[model samples]
Target chain A: MAEKKRELVSGSRLVDENSLKERLIVIFTKWEVILAVLIVFEFILFSNLSPYFLDYFNLMNSTFTFMEKAIMALPMIFIIMSGDIDISIASIIALCSFSMGFASSHEIGAAGIVIIGLLAGLSAGMVNGFLVTSFKMPAIAVTLATQSIFRGISQAILEDQAYTKYPEKFAYFGQGYLGETLIPFELVLFLVLAAIMGFVLHKTQYGRKLYAIGNSKEAARFSGVKVDRARFINFTLMGLFCGISAVLLTSRIGSTRPNIALGWDMEVITLVVLGGVSITGGKGNLFGVLMAIFLLGYLKFGMGLINLSAKVMIITTGLLLIIAVLLPGFLDTVKARRKLRRQQKESGMVEV
Target chain B: MSIPTSIKTITQRRETSLILLIGVLLFGVTMRAPNFVSVTNIERIVNDTSILIMVSIGQFFVILTGGIDLSVASMIGLSGMSAAMINQYNPGMPAGFVLIIGMLIGMVLGMINGAAVAYGKVPPIITTLGTMSIYRGMTFVISRGQWVTAHEMTESYMNLPHGNFLGISNLIWWGIVVSVIMFYFSKYTKRGREIYAIGGNKVAAKFVGVEEKKIHMTIFTLSGILSGIAGVMWTSRFAAAVNETAAGFELQTVAACVIGGVSIAGGSGAVVGVVLGALFLGIINNALPVINLSPFYQMFIQGAIVLVAMLINTLSEKRREQELLKGRQQ
Candidate 1:
C-alpha cells in the first residue's frame, strides 16, 4: 500500500503537462481553497434562504453571535496542534464571568472587574496545566474534571441568580461599532487577536515546537524540546483567551449567570475541527479556522433566519462535525482507488 | 517477582484503596447524620444506584476497549422516551416487551455509532459526540416537546421497578443480574477476551488475529443496549419520561468507571471495582441531602472526587508499571 502511494505520487509528478482540469483539481485539493469556495457558497445560499441575511447590518451583527467562540478558537488551534485538548474552556468562561459579575455587584470599577475575570480564567488554566503537566494526566480527563469543577463552583456561587448591573461603558466592548462602518468592536478585537495568534502559530519557533511535540512527544522530548513546558504554555494561553471571551460574552449578554456559555466548548472545538485541524494534532492552520468560524457563524445565522429551533441547529452542527472529520479520509480513499484502477489499466494495456 | 503475583498485588491494592476511601466517606457522613445508616435509607440508596451501576457496566466495556460513548445519556433519553410512549399508547402491552423494545432502540443506535467508528474510520469521540446530539434531537422529535407524566403511565409499568423480589427492589435485582452477566462474559467468553486484548494493545491483538473493527462495533453496540435498559429502568422508577431523561448521566458513568480503577487508556478493571465505585457515588448522593449539604455543592464534590480518583489511579498505575519493570529486571 505504501509503495502504491509512492508510485502514484511519483507518476503524477512525472507528468509535467499540467492540464487545466489537473490545475483545478490541485487548487481545489488545498483545504483553504475549498474552504473559501464553501464560504462563498454558504453566503449565497444563506442570502437566498432569508431576505434579511443579505442585509449588511444583519451580517455585521451576526458576527457577535460567534465572536467570543471565535476568539477562543484562536488559542485552541495552538492547543489542538500541540496534541492536547481542553474541554473546560466553557466552564472557565462561566467561572471568569461569574467573578467579573461578583466584582461588579460589589461595586468594583470596570477595569478591576475585567482584571479579576481574566485572573480567574488564568488561574483556572494554570490548574489544568499543573495537573496535566505535573501528574502527567491525560489532557482530556483532566480538562473534563476541571470543566465540571469550574462550572460547579460557578453554580455554587451564583445559584439561580444572575448579575446584571454593569457600568454602561461595559456594553461597548461587546455592542460597540466603529463610527459608520458597521464593524463591531468585538469583531475587531477578535481579528486583531487572530492575527497575533496566526503569526505566533505560523512564523515562530515556538509554533514549530508545538507541531513537533504534537507529531511525536517522545521524539520532540528527545530532540531537546521542552514538550511539557510548551504544552503548559499552550494550555495557559487557552485559558487567557477563555477569559477574554468571558469578558466579551458577559458584556454582550449584559448579565452573568452560572450557566452562561454552557456547551460553548463543544462549539469552539467544532469550529477548530471544521477548520481542518486534525484532532490527533500536528496539522492545520489559522486561515482555515478563520474561514470555518465564518462558515458556521453564517450557517447558524441563516438557519436562525429560517426559524429553525436551537435543537435543530445542534443537530446540524453535530452532523457537520462528523462530515468534516470524515470527508477528508473518504476523499483520500476515493483518490487512492482511482489511482489503483488507472495503474491497472495502464499495466494491462502495456502487456496487450 | 513473578508477573502474575505482581499483577495480583496491584489489583488488590487498588481495590483496597477504593474500599478505604469509601469507608472514610461513609464514616464522615455517618458522623454528621446517623440517620443515613438506617435500613430504609440504605435500601433507597441501593435502589437509586441501580441505574448508575448498569450504565457504568456498559461504559466499562467501552472504556475497557479504550473508547468512550458520549452518547449514552442521549441513548438513555431516547430509549426512556420510547419506552414511555409505548406504555402510554399500549396500556395492555407487557412490561417486559417495553423493556425489550427500549433495549432494541439502544442496540440500533449503538450499532450506528459502532459502524461509524469502526468502519467509517471516524474517531470515537467525534462519532459519539455527533450521535449524541442526533439521538437527543430524535428524542425531542419523537416526543414533540411533550413529557409523559407519571399519571399517564400504566400501573404495571410503574410498578415494575418498585416491586420487590426476595426482599429487594426489582431494580436492584436487575443491576445484580447485569453485573453478573458482564462479569462472567468478560471473564470467560472469547469475544470478551478480545475486547480486553484490543484495548490492551491494538497492534498486538491484530497480530494475534483479533478483528479490531468487529470488537469495536460489538462493544459500542453493547454499551447502547445497556444504556437502553437503564433508560427503561429510569422511566419505570420515576414513572415519567421526557426528552431530558438522562441528561449528563454519561459523565457520571465515566466518573464511576475511573473511580473503580478502570484505566481510561483501556484493558484493565473488574466488575467488582465498578460496583464499588457506583456504591461510593451512591452513598455520596444519598448522604448529601441527609447531612444537610446544599444541593448546589453536589456537582463540585462529584467533580473533585473524579479528579482525585483519577490522580490516584494515575499515580498507582505508574507505580505498578515501575514494579513490573523491577520484576523483569530481577
Candidate 2:
C-alpha cells in the first residue's frame, strides 16, 4: 500500500513539473513581456500622477527630447552585442557638429553641410577603428583617448563661442513634422533606423558573427570569424551614427558648443544595457533594446510632466540600469533553488 | 653586471623612462620660460598635482585587480561636499575628524561598488558607471544646488591641505606619505601579492585558494578611502565644495596610470611610475600657460600625449612577446 501511494505521488509530481516548466519557459523566454508589463505599469502610474502625461500630442512631441539618443542607441546595441564598446560617440558628435558648423561658416548649402558632418564622423570613427584593430589596443582605452582627442579639437576650435547660423532647411531633420501628421522627422528617422538595425541584427550573417564573437573571441576566430574587422566595422558604424545624431542635435538646438551632447555616452550605454544587452557580451536581443528605449523615454517624459528635476531622472536611470543587470541573475537563482528543493523533496519521499 | 647591462636595466624600468620624460619636459619648458624651473614654480607644479597623485595611487589599487572605479570623480564630489557641509555646520570640528568621516562615507560607497562587482557578478565598468551617476545625483540631492564657498569654510579647515609644514606645503607631504604607504603595501604585503595573483590569472588564483571576493571588495574600499582623502584635500585647497568639484577628474587619474605603464590588462604597475606620470601631466598643465600656449590647447595636448604613450606601450609589449618567442624557439 505504501509503494502504491509513492507511485501515485510521483506520477502527480511529473504532471505538476511539466506545467511548471511551461510557465517558467514563457516567463523567462520573453524578456519583452517583462518590459511591456513595466511599460504598462509606468503608464498607469504616471498618467494618474500627472494630468498632462496622457495627452497624445504631448506624447508624440516628447520624442524630440530623446530622438538623438535613441538613434545613437541603435548602433550602440550592435557595439555591445559584439562585446566591445565605444564611449567616444558623444565626442564624435561634437567633432561632427564642429565640422558642419565650419562648413556652414563657409556658406556651404544644407546638403553639403550634412555630408561634411557625416564624413567627419566617418573619419573620426575610422581613427578609433584603426587604433583599436591595427594596434590591438582594447576598445575602452582607445575610445577613452579618442574621446579626449575629438572633444579637444572641438573645444580648441569653438572656445566658448557658439555656432548658430545654419541654413533654414537644415532644421527640418531635427524639428519638422511628417506630412499631415504629428510625428516628428527625427522620430520617423529613429524608427526607420531602428527597423534597419533590428533587421540587420536578427537577419544577417554579420549579426550571427557578432553573437559568436561576443561569446568568445578566440573561439570565434578559430572558427574563421574576422573578429577585429567586425569590431572595426561596428566602431565605424558608431561614428556614422554619431554624425547623424550630431546633425539632428545641432539642428534642434540651433547652436553648437564645445560641450554639446556632454555625458550622452553614459545615457546611451544605459539604454542599451537596460534593453537586455549584456555588457559582458553574448546575451541579449534587439527587440529587448527597443523596448528599453521606449520604456525609458516615456519614463523621462512622465518624470518631466510631474515637475521632477533632471537630477532625479539621472538617479532613476542609474538605478534602472543596475536593477536590469541584477534581476536576471536573481531570478535564475530563485528558479534553480526551487527546482533543487522540489527534486530533493521528491527523492526523500520516494525513499520513505 | 657589466656597465652596459646595468644601464640597460636602469633604462628598462618604466619609472626611469618616465623620469627621463619629465626631465625632457622640464628642459623644454625651461628653454621657453626660464622662470619655469625656479624653486617657487617647481613647488607650484608639485602642489597642483598633489591631489592627482593621491587619486592615481588609489586608482592603481583597483586597476591592479583588473577593475576600474569610474565613480572616483563622483566619489570625490560627494565626499568633499559632505565634509564641507560638516565643517559649515560645526565650525570647530577637527580636520582629522572630518577627514575620517569623509573617508567612512567614501568607504561605504566603495563597498557598494565592490559588492555589486564581486558578489553580484556585475562587470566593474558597468558597476562603476552606474554608481558614477547615482553618486553625482545624490550630491545634487544633498546639497540642493547649494555651494559651500570660501567664506563659508573655517580657516583651520582650509589650512588642512594648503598649510605649509617645515618649508613644504602639507599637500605635497600628503602626496608623498600616501605614495610611500601604497608602494610598501603593493610590494610587501601578502594581500598585495594575492591581488597580483588574482589579476594575473583568476583561475590559477582560485585553484590556489585565494579569496577573490574579499580582495575585490577590499580593492575598491581602498580606492574609496584614498578618493575620500583627496576629496577633503580638493575642497580644502579650493576652499569650496560644490556639486561640480573634481568633475571629469577620473580621466586624469586613469591617464596617470596609463602613462605610468600600469598595464590596462592588469597585474603590473609601480607607485613610482604613477607618481612620475602624474607629474608629467602636472608639468604640461603648468608649462602650457608659461609657454604662452592658450589654455585651449591643454585638452588637445593631453589627449595626444596619452595616445602616443599608449601606442608606445603597446608596441613595446608586442616586441617583448616576440623576443620571448625567439628565446623559446632557440
Candidate 3:
C-alpha cells in the first residue's frame, strides 16, 4: 500500500499542474512546435498583408485545391519513412480519376465510380509494391516506371479528350461548403483525417510498428513486427487515399485530363518535409505536417495575392524547399557554436 | 571464391545477352522498316544518339552516385537560350567565348545543386526537383517565353557542328570522344574511383577520409557541364532556343542512364555500358517516328521502353544478389 502510494505521488508529480509551464517550455523547444508557431505567425502576417487572405471564401478555395494532394501525402509520409518513396502518387491519382471518368461515361454512378477509382489505385499500388519488394528495385525506380505506366493507361483511355459527364452532386465533394461559414467539405474531411492520423501516430501500437519498420526492417522483422505486411498495408492505404483524392480532384476540376496534377508528387513531398517530418523516417508528427500544410497553403495564397507570376511561385517553392531543409542544419551549427563559446567562457580555453 | 565465380558468370551472361538483344532488336526494326538500315536513317540515329549520349553521360555520373538530376532538361533549356542570346546579342563575339559563357552558366547552376545536395544535406531528388522548376522558371522570365529563331542565330555558331570529318557527323565524333574520355576517367582516374567509392558506401568512404561533399559537388558540376554542352550543341543544331525546348529531356537522360545499366542505387556501373544504353534508346527514338506514330504515342512508347529496361536491369541485379547469397551458403 505504501509503495503504491509512492508510485502515485511520483506519477502525479510528472503531470503536476505547476508543471504545465514546464510542458509548454518543452513544446516550444521542439522543432514541430516551432514550425507550428511559425505557421500561426505567417497566417497572421498574411491576414494583415492582404484583406482577402483571411476571408472564408479564399481559405475554402485554397483548402479544396490542396486537399487531394494532401490526402495522398499522409500515406507517402509512411512510405518515405521506410526509406522509400512513391513518385507515382500523381500518376495513381490520374489513373483513378481516369477510371472514374471511364466508368461515368459507361453510365456508372456514385458507387461504381468509387469502386473503379479504388481498384485502379489499389492495382497500381500493388504493382509498385510488388516490383519494389520482389525485384528489389529501388522504390524511386519502380515508382518512376509506374508513373509512366499508370499515366500511359490514362492516356490510352482518354487520349486528348477529357471526361466531364459527372452528375452535378459529385462536385459537392470538391467544391461544396459546410454550413454558411464557407468551410469546404474537403477541408473538413482533411481535418478529420488529420485528427485520426494524429491519434494513430501518437497514441497507438500500430504507429509504433511503422516507426520501427522504417528505422530498420531487419530488426523489425526479427522483433516480429511484420514489416512486409506493414508496407503492404501502407501502400494500400496510399492507394485508398489516392482514390479518395481522385473523387475530389475529378469533381473539383469537373473534368479528367491526362495532365491533371502532372507534378503533384513533389509538392506532397515538399509539404511532408516542410512539416518537419524527417525524410529519413522513424520520426515525424502529424501536427508538424498540419502546420506545414497551412503554411504552404498560406504562403502560396499570400504570393498569389501579391500577383506573383506562376513561374515566380515555382521558384519560390524551390527556394523555400531548400531553405526549409537547410534551416535545421543551420540551427544545429549555430547551437554548436554557442555551446563552444559557453564552454570556452567557463574553461578559459576552447576544447581542442 | 564461389561468389566471385558466380559474379563473373553472371557478368559474362549479361554482356552477351545485352549484345544479342540489341542485335535482335536492330534486325526486327530493319525488317519492319527497310529504310531503317540506310545511311540516311543511320545518320539520323547518330544525330539523335549524340545529343542523348552527351546528356546521359552526365546523368550516368550522378546516378552512379545514386542521385537524379531533374534539372538536366532545364539546364538544356537555359544553356541553349544563353548560347542563342549571346550569339544574337553580341554580334562578332568569338564563338569559343560564347560557348564558354554558356558552359559556365550551366556550371554555376550545377554548383548550386551540388551545394544544396552536399552541404545543405537536402535529398538530391528534392534539391534537383526544386532547381528543375527554378531554372526553367528563370529561363521563362529571361526569355519572356519567346523562341530564338534561326534568323537571330549567327552563321559561325551554326557552322560549328555542320563541318564533319571522315564522312561522320561532328556531333557523333564529339559523342565518341566524350564517351571515351568519360570511360577512361571512370575506370582509371582517382577522382573517378572516388565517385564510385562514395556511391558504394558514403559512410565507409567517410571513414577512409573521402570528402563526400567535395566529390558530390564535383560530379554534379560535371553533370551540369555535360548538359550545358548538349544545350550548346542542340541550339547550334536547330539554331533555335525556347523555354519549353528540351522540356522532358531529363527523363530521357535518366532513361538512357538506367537502360545503360547505371544502378540508381549508386556504384557498380560502367561508362561504356551507359554509352551503349544511350545508343539503344537512340535507336528506338530514331525508328519510332519513321513508322508514323503520333508524337504522343511516341512518348508513351518511349516511357514504356524505359520502364521495361529498368525492370529487366533490376531483375538481373536481384538475381545476381541472390546467386551471391546462395554461393556464400554453398
* Predicted candidate 3 versus true structure: per-residue lDDT over B261-281, tens digit per residue: 778899867877777777887
Judge the docking of candidate 3 as incorrect, acceptable, medium or high: medium
Tens digits of per-residue lDDT, candidate 2, B234-261, equal 9999999999888889989999988998
* Deviation of model 2 at B145, angstroms: 0.5
* TM-score of structure candidate 3: 0.90
Question: Quality of candidate 2's docking, in CAPRI categories?
Answer: medium
lDDT of 2 at B34: 87
Q: Please give the C-alpha DockQ score of model 1.
A: 0.71
| Candidate 1 clashing pairs, residues 3+ apart or interchain | none
What is the Å distance of residue A54 in model 2 from its true position?
1.2
Q: Judged by DockQ, which candidate is best?
A: 2
Please state every model's RMSD to the true fold in angstroms. Answer: 2.6, 4.4, 4.8
Top-down DockQ ranking: 2, 1, 3
Regions of candidate 2 where Cα sits further than 4 Å from its true position: A1-17, A20-30, A345-352, B1-6
Model 2's DockQ score? 0.77
